[model samples]
Target: MTHNPDFKDGAAYIGGEFVPIGEAKISVLDWGFTRSDAVYDVVHVKDGRFFRLDDHLARFERSMARRRIELAEDRQALKDILVRCVQLAGLTDSYVAMVASRGRPRVKGSRKPSDCANHLVAYAIPWIDVIPLEVQERGAKLLISDHPRVADEAVDPTVKNYQWSDLTSGLFDANDEGFDTAVLCDGRGMVTEGPGFNVFAVIGGGLVTPERGCLHGITRQSVIDICGKEGIVCRAGDLPRADLETAEEVFLCTTAGGIMPIAQVGERVIEAGAPGPVTRRVMASYTAMHEDAAYVTFVDTPTRFAAAE
Candidate 1:
């Protein structure tokens, strides 16, 4: 059934129907809201084209599966919803997210996961940058959090869920220290990642990032791929706090911000405290690839609201 133009304009999909974002809401009893029993993924759109849509969708599928959340929508259906969400917002650059949640239990008092149904929710809003443009331009200052990241056994970082207590606490610690962001280390004192961003360091003419205790970010994978094509050596393994502090350069990767260079890690300046040469090369290549047809998915060809506009 076709929805009204207003319903599809700057709207959101909730419970399989289109409504304004302000009206989109889930049940208060939903485990997704109560227990963070949900997984989500975001893909950015530029010039009405989605970047790495397929990769993001694949990851979202994996996250949902890991959480044992089953939904009726398939990949194609989800893709259509994403495109529609972006089109509805009439945004050229947007932040698009898809979420799968364990719905409220069928029996109000049931404690079994089996009694709950899974549901999907998604939205597209104006573009978001994990590191704001000004911060990116000036380079970011990072504080090493005394707080450790949540253990992999407790909650898998590989599955992107709403379990952000540790991350948020790190941010608070960073804020108190007058820093732009925070990166948490594991209990073993190995550098993990920052809130909503993956960490990387350039040392001995190669790139090294933590192999564990970090989300396998889509943007991180893009940087690694670009490295292979550009003949820049990049590896993933255990990165200690000392290694990060003494690195020649540091940067962050995220779906929201793309590539962000670091100026300092707790007052230890990186490469004269500016975006380094390798970081610049990667950022330039990443920007140029946005125009590559291979990575862009268009959603405006037959936009439902084009006639009204």
Candidate 2:
């Protein structure tokens, strides 16, 4: 992003203006910044446009409800802000991020109802390719964590938030232990999810994942959609630790990271010791689908909230 002396020297979007991220201003006393009490979403961009835009926005809205935070901007407005940010950054196939927080004043009388926010941030990174090239080349390894994923009833994992202190501990342990990623299970000892992704298994002659507890990752859903078209039987049910160890294939699904195949589970080697056939097919299908997706772009002509202006 071009540096502007007028802004704080960091590239960011504040209210409806583009400024350096550092220059972008918000209240330190704003409950949103002070409290990690916020909800957010990131939309995967393909070919300079967002994929499943509506679906992502719906999740953001639901997350706001879950956090008891009102959306600072509505659906159409959010899209406009994202497009402007992406255009400014010159990103193609990037991620559009949004965060909404509780509108509270840091000081008692500084309160402003307009301080509620659906703050925006944007960046582009290479396709996460599900499996890292290094891991895929050497065969992926996992260090199962004793870390417990929060139960859906206690706190829904689907609500994307900043409270990642739990996952960070597991990731640190996994890093020291020389593992690619960390895994977590629900209160029932059933595999709930990974630190930032969804888990899948090839068992009972069908593909399976834990139902509803983990983030309803759009990536996982797309893979399931491909399975039907490609004649791969699929299932969603409880996934126990032993079930994964004994399964024919294991992998993870996420938006930024697509389909990551699990080659080594703990010290035991999985079958074939590489990306499995099902994961491969799904990955290829997803790539083709997005590369040829229909995009909705924001027209260059400006749209105005005439009353506010």
Q: Pick the candidate with the highest lDDT.
A: 1
Candidate 1 similarity to native, TM-score: 0.95
lDDT tens readout by residue for model 2, 38-131: 7777777666657777777888889877766765577888766665555555556565667676645534665554444445443223344444
RMSD of each: 2.5, 4.2
Give residue 138's lDDT in candidate 2 (0 to 100): 66
lDDT of 1: 0.88
The count of backbone overlaps in candidate 1 is 0
Candidate 1 local lDDT, 56-152, one digit each (tens): 9999999988878898988987888888888777788888889998999998789888799889998888888998999999999989899999998
What's model 1's lDDT at 112? 87
By TM-score, the best candidate is 1
Error of 1 at 249 (Å): 0.6
